[model samples]
Target: MQPLQNAGYDRAITVFSPDGRLFQVEYAREAVKRGTTSLGVKSDEGIVLVVDKRTSSKLVETKSIEKIFQIDDHIGAATSGLVADARSLIERARIESQVYKITYNEPIRVDNLAKKICDMKQLYTQNGGVRPFGSALIIGGIFEGESKLFETDPSGALIEYKATAIGSGRSDAMDVFEDKYEEGMSLDAAIDLALDAVYEATEGKTSAESVEIAVIEKDTEKYRKLSQEEVSSYIDQLVEKKSNDEEETESEE
Candidate 1:
């Protein structure tokens, strides 16, 4: 017999409360916030996509937990939130890329493909009985000699960023970016910055086995995931630099 607080607006995806907010869409965003940290950084040389897998058990095979995906030869995406929901969007992105190729005889542009996915996500919010996708994506690529990075929300909003993060540790990751991100850093430098951000976000809990990285270089325009050996090398470099910086700070203090 209790009275409704939201006036029943929270019960349906299609309903909006008096405050002009969609409760279901907000809940979907909450799901993304609860997921592990994922981020993207764009530099003059290319783009880097990074994700923390946050493996909770030793027995779980790290390779089987995929958070980064290739949408086309040039475009890649890093996702946070419900993995299954992200898989559906990834599939749609791949199909969109192929369809554009068949129709226009060229690969899809990074922003265009992201818009297409956001359109699909928007459709779910307007229709009754369908819930918003509980996920967010960081899509990056090289298009026509230019680098692009985009972030998509469950409410179907899309934004372009020089460097950005999604999920639980976004604030920590973004603080690092704000301090260190440069507009035209080399691809190697961008990768270093990305590692630094993820390190802060995960509170230094990251290792090669618990992280995934992919990159699209302007020279190659190919989406490539780093191998375990490559990831390990980067992790080692990050650890060494962090140790050195701490030593310097302590000596100064």
Candidate 2:
């Protein structure tokens, strides 16, 4: 009998198909691609993380859907893909940070924490019986007085970025960043750019309640989430600017 199409290559996480591809890992990446949009921007002043909660119903509490997490005083993460899997990975990250601090009497470096998480992710891909985590993380923080941003995928690959986005709206968000991102931007400018990216990613469907924002300031080294009111003000500003720009185009015509 002829073998089945794909020859069951994707049946196990440990299996690798010809041309050096792991189908299971790629499938996990697809889970991330289908998740809600999340992005991170790094500037000299700090790092900004923005996520679209995309609450579907009014009955659901906006606060209950958390796509951002604080792993340490200086470290924060934004996630896309399976939220449960993201939470599990976050819990492990928190533990790793604490353990490192207790053992070394100093907070773990941002890169080190990212590597630990990626190591665990890599392990699952090489082992059988367990599936890879269907999530990707955009981790940002202050390390040695410097701001850093890192992105990790389900396949254990890690990349550092000045600004990056993941999930279903990644392309839209990235298009904005590629055009506008600049180095040495102030924290306020970073926040504005991040909000703009989120707005583009969501196709202007975002509201203060359906979005979350966080920042890790380089000087303070503290992670903080912007209050709903602050988020609202920013959203209003962006909306008004967009409206005004449209009006100008109409006048030119």
lDDT string, candidate 2, 1-253, tens digits: 5246556788855587775778889899999999999999998889999999996688998889999999999999999999999999999999999999999999999999999999999998998799999999999999888998999999899999999999999999999999999878998898889888988888888788888999999889999999999999988998998889889999999
Off by over 4 Å in 1: 1-3
Residue-pair clashes, model 1: 0
**Model 2 TM-score, all chains together:** 0.96
RMSD of candidates 1 onward, in order: 1.5, 1.9
Clashing pairs in 2: none
Where does candidate 2 stray beyond 4 Å? 1-5
- For residues 58-90, what per-residue lDDT tens digits would candidate 1 score against the true structure? 999888999999999999999999999999999
What's each prediction's TM-score?
A: 0.97, 0.96
